[model samples]
Target: MQYTAMLDFRTCFDARKDIASLLKQEQSSGVDTGADTGVPRQVRVLGQERDGAVLYTWSDVSPYRQDDVVVSHIGLYEPISKVNTVLFVHEKLVNLVNCTVNQERTLLGFTTQEKAATSSSGSPSWHSEGRHHAQVYRSYLAEVQPANRVFYLNIERDNYLMVQFLHGKGQGYGDTSSKESHMLFLIHKELIGLYHMKLSRVGYSGVEMCGQPRTEVLAKRFQWAQWDHQRQRLYYLSQKKKNSNSKMTFTCMQFYEKHPPEVMMEVQVRIYLPPEVSKAPSTYEHLPLSKKVTDQKLLCEVMTLPGGSLCICYQHPIMNPDDHHGQEEDIGEYDVVDIEYSVFMLHRGTALHCCMPGFARLEAVNIKLHFFPFSE
Candidate 1:
């Protein structure tokens, strides 16, 4: 009803019988019919079919550009032979149905009447601020190449449940023209158990198979840590300990954190062990190489700044290759010492800066200060 009033279009249909009856009544009064003929021609209208459902054309308006338009529709039906006789369905109901059918997102749980009720009452309701607008939940996903940097993500209040999955090049499932496929999953609060079980079982596709829900009101504070030291640095630089004038070449890694403006970000950094120390033990040695590689990790927070840079420090011993922090007893005869630095991040749908190799002199080095949210 509000949409019809706002658009100011007469797209509703009046019953043929009612129009005929009205015309006959006007004719009996000797009123001229020539002027009345053009009244119906100005309005773009549609009528109910023989099956009793009214068909109408609908358009999905683009928020960014006015010219970018999409056309779709919705239909409504009423049961015949009703005593109450509220009569035919109105255009406003048809518009509401069209919005739902066309996937034009609105408030997830709250209804139009509920929102109106809260507005009328002037209460601090759940649908306050930008929650009532579909634009608030807008999400964008893109594709990126694998590299070595940490990603700082800031999840919006209710948009966390909108899980998005993207397929890389050659992983197309639906559209051929697209090099990647994207899918969104909305998990409800009540269905979280099922969601968790599915996620633990088969990853994101499990959420897709569980239910194709449009929106879910699932909001809960979650704190967790993940280790992703799977990627290894390909090549590392080593300088002779005795050479004082040796050139130091460092590999630089750039990272980006894409998030909505003004949101705080938290990131976990995972640095893989340097290549030299990670090498297998010599064949003549009695001890074999340890299968597990210990990774050094740190937690960092980012503030409202849109973009920032970070650097990890690499420490190599000059006097003693096996000496680390004066802990000489832990070094074995066959052990080789090395210093390495690496980084990783997820942008669009690709992993970046996962494995970069660099070497530096031994010292108690601090990471770049600006990388953290707060600096001392």
Candidate 2:
């Protein structure tokens, strides 16, 4: 609920560069500086409690931008190596800047763009004339086409997942036309896997299938989605129309390189209101003539907690104002009402549905919910 500031973006960037330079100097001279160097190191503490525990704080600063380069994403890389590194992604490059204390190393960078334009004959341009010798050979996984722009990037060890948007020729960022498609790429070292999907007025549809037709099991646009890097699983909430009523379902899915996404578990979302809020009052004379009690639910947001828990905020109608009421009918119906926001935690199966780390099984658990009241 509360946050404290620690390091800013500019400070972190400069510290990483300084550490990297120190490591390079020691490597060339074959010297172990250690504690003898008398240099102060940067310390980062995270996720500590207040009661007899070290309270580490982190602050989020705006992305660093210089000249034509704009940082699109910034995150701490998974601790696969001995050195702690901060990851930075821009339109054309990915940089892993070391941020370790006394121990430091050179920065790692990768170009995420393709060189040389396509010829007018629709053939490979690199093979023609004098361009063949000048062409820079790069892996398929590292090359992102000029037409596509990365919208999301997630890195876990050697695996990289990038979601790109194929935009029009003159379209800017976040601008999408009807013909645009979203491309999902998963790269493990040199190997590349791709999943392409297009959004239509109805829902989402796959642009290509592996072997057989999969039209029946395709899902619509996700209402909410969260990815768990540790488990390599993705959890999402979607709505399904059953006859006249619509139902929401929470699903756990996993992605594979050679195959399509695998569905792990699915459960219908159910919310049970408290008895006090669900029941209507017996007296109606004190209420406005143009208003009545109604039971309607509206979803606000869905987010994942730290310990693999999910939280949902929604609003339930306690009193509904009649839209058909005329201005001359009653002035009390237009009176301003005070809104109340309340927070409560409910158990799964009884109120919400959640999946556990055990994978296949669905457990009944408690989830926190925030409710907001509305008059209209």
Candidate 3:
């Protein structure tokens, strides 16, 4: 029995030695199958590929390749007085990466001094520094529709992060099919959760072409009306007409505490057009070159209750030669109409109605609030 045990132990030792030799060969081969070892932290250029892919070998393994057309870049820079050594690069700006010692590489290895990140336009300063560092584990790019063009980012107003995209079909000019959708998302400094305007998965009507001419009266119909965070109320503007001959109703839909959570108010507005403007056609291809609407009526339902009010306003005039040059006059004169709406309590539900009346009418409605929700 003792002789048999000795023979088994010898066989196990021989097998262990064979495995270690194979592992050592793998480490030397440098295929990078994700293994870690303690070694000096010097930057090493591991190897290059014929296809132009380069590998940066260090404590971590990183392979980088970039295409043209990406001009701006953002990444982490390790500064030593006047020089910057880029320890990490963000994938979003990886297009600026190059195998040769390029300008970005030069900038990375040389930063004059640490200063507050300055902003010009269309870009912001991306800098992060502290003893404890935050690292991104994984990132991915979203496949957006081709119709989604470019977007503007403004960090100053309401700390707003707005992403505007063209939704649905018919994105062509005079294409009444597709409409612009504003997706609003709010980020709070304290909370990691996202605060956004709630949308109803269902309930809203789709945009429809009314008459034969298909003149777009409410082509881009939905606009932000108001948002009272404290009250948990949100409002949006829309225009609806019963028929081709009927008058148009300016409508407002109020959302409760949660976005698209619940309907708290419904407001409809109708503007009283002046006699001269009222005589205009239901769907006129051209303006009559004069007059404007000046009065408004509100049929509002707050929560579940109903109430309304009438508003009368004055007519004003303006002269702008660039707008239109009628054959009647060298320079045409038109009426400038301004109407304002104010909400009052007493009803459980809310409603707002607005109308514009005139042959050559120009309307401007101003609603002043503590914080403006929409940006051009």
Give me the runs in candidate 1 sitting further than 4 Å from their true place: 1-117, 127-163, 174-376
Better of 2 and 3 by lDDT: 2
Q: What C-alpha lDDT values do all the predictions have?
A: 0.24, 0.31, 0.25
Q: Which regions of candidate 2 fall more than 4 Å away from where they truly are?
A: 1-218, 242-245, 255-261, 271-320, 323-349, 352-376
lDDT tens digits by residue: candidate 2, 72-136:
32222222232323333333342321111000111111212234345787654653223332222
lDDT of 3 by residue, 117-147 (tens): 4457433344322212111111111111211
Sum up the clashes in candidate 1: 15
Error of 1 at 223 (Å): 4.4
Model 2, CA-based lDDT: 0.31
Q: For residues 1-376, write the lDDT of model 1, one tens digit per residue.
A: 3544323346343533334333344546655322122222121122222223332222332223345343222222232521111111121312221110001110111001111223455653343233442212222221111111111112222222232222222222222222212232332111111111011113322111122223322222221111111111111122322232333222221111121112122233332223432232111110111111112222221122234333333332222453455565554444532333232332222223322224233222222222222331
The lDDT, on a scale of 0 to 1, for candidate 1 is 0.24
* Cα TM-score per model: 0.19, 0.30, 0.23
Worst 10 residues of 1 by lDDT: 98-107
Comparing 1 with 3 on lDDT, the higher-scoring candidate is: 3
Cand. 3 TM to true fold: 0.23
